[model samples]
Target: MELRHLRYFTVVAETGGFGRAARMLHVAQSAISEQIRDLERELGVSLFNRENRRVRLTHEGEQFLEDARTVLDAANRAVTNMQRSQRGELGKLTVGFFVGGMGPFFSSIIREFRRVYPGIQVSLVEMAPGMQYQALQAGSIDVSFTRALPAIHASQLRSEPLRNEPFYAVLLRTHPLARKKTISIRELSEETFVLNDRRYSPAVFDKVITLCTEAGFSPKIGATGSVSSGVIALVEAGEGVAILPQGSRILSSSDIVWIPLSDKDAVIDMVLAWSPKLEQPALRSFLELVRRRRKQVGI
Candidate 1:
């Protein structure tokens, strides 16, 4: 009938006698008998054949005994799990990232979290900002690191600003503009630029176009792709120059040079965003880790 009833029934079935079950359950023999009778009555079947000397289970009782034990065991485990979750010890955490630059920090955070909370499991998904937002909205991910999220996606999520990485110009090592430590907007006006399509990373693209226009010339566009990595590869091949966040590290190559853009406001925010619907304990722990490491990244 209730959790207590199943627990009392299972104990009696295991011990095979009310007197012994009562002792094992820390209840009086009469109280144990009454609870087992109530469980049988609620189920509409006799669970045990009564005898002055020994007790045996009825056919229905044998099947019900197994079910009862299973229920009791599961209930106990649920309680234990919830208690651990409350202590930030046991749970699942799902996180999404927009770029690979977080690889080292994320790995360190995961190792530390495991040492501190061995019972929790974490899942990490890396995707572009738009896909990460959709995953958060659909309840597939709990938290994320993203850049240039739009107002529509921002409405469905809570974002915390972590750091700002200013724009930098990427060029082949032999390119003329690679000579400057920082180039003014006016200086790069005549250069051909390659980048992700406007629809892919709109905020950055719009700013780049506006800055170029404000500098008094339209950009001589060379190529556009749908991904950041693709844009970087094209820049590497000397197809065109590119402006991206300084956080976008250029790998070791003989032909690539990264130089900062001189505009004071030319920067992209790296932020932590999450759906408003989630308040999972494991997610909270992960956010704490992100916050700690974001500072190390100079947020």
Candidate 2:
């Protein structure tokens, strides 16, 4: 039988009369009586015993009532869950972040998002800038916290500058310039540089080379690491010094020192990038939260 038939039958049983059930349901009494009769004929069982002015449930009616209530409850819950998902209040969001930085800012945004939408599950993946871009294009990740590279121009992708900060020189604690508050880019002319692979972050690699060249000498490249953490590890091992975004300072070890760069133009932009085609309600909710938190923190 149809859900309306079951509903009418339940209401009739509850009110103990078709007249009252019709009044409660805002329907004609004859309509309610006809629906109940149709339900009984379909089920081949009488659901109610009608007296002069009252009604009572038969044995089969009691058993079917509980099952019908269970079905209706489940159906209601399903509808509610679907609506919540559509509203961006429930689901999973996969976010990508660069391996070296994004610790503080990313963590803060995620914490605030979790507070606001606890029903949405957030998962983090550590990827290089290039990999993050690829993941976004391939639908593997919802959004990414990465650097803006000149070579990474995509019509379907959008990038918003989240934070811009100057680069810092990461040096071994035993290095002579480690004690300095600030070091000029020219001072590193004689020092070997630990660089990140260009494929991993082309913008950072090109910026470092440009800065060194502008300082009147080519950077003596000692070694290249695939990621920022690896570059820091090399610096800690005294392989060479490296210049990284200010946020990279959080990844510093006790054996390494972070000194500000003297060059004013030596800066990098930390960006939030995503594909417009993949914008789901959950991702939109997250983007809105990011904007709100960024404004609150004056980022």
lDDT of 2 by residue, 139-249 (tens): 899999999845555676888888887999999889988899999999989999999898888879999999998889999899998988889999988899999987777
Which residue pairs collide in model 1, if any?
173-255
lDDT digits (tens) for residues 1-299 of candidate 1: 78988888888888889999989888999998998888878889999999646788989999998888888889999999999898678888787875533546556777887887788887888776767778888989888777756888878788888667778888888887678888887787778889767665666677788778777789989998566777888988778988877656744356788888888777777777888687677777777776877677775
* Reference-based lDDT, residue 129, model 1: 74
lDDT of 1 at 139: 86
Report the C-alpha displacement of residue 25, candidate 1, in angstroms: 5.8
User: TM-score for every candidate vs. truth?
Assistant: 0.78, 0.89
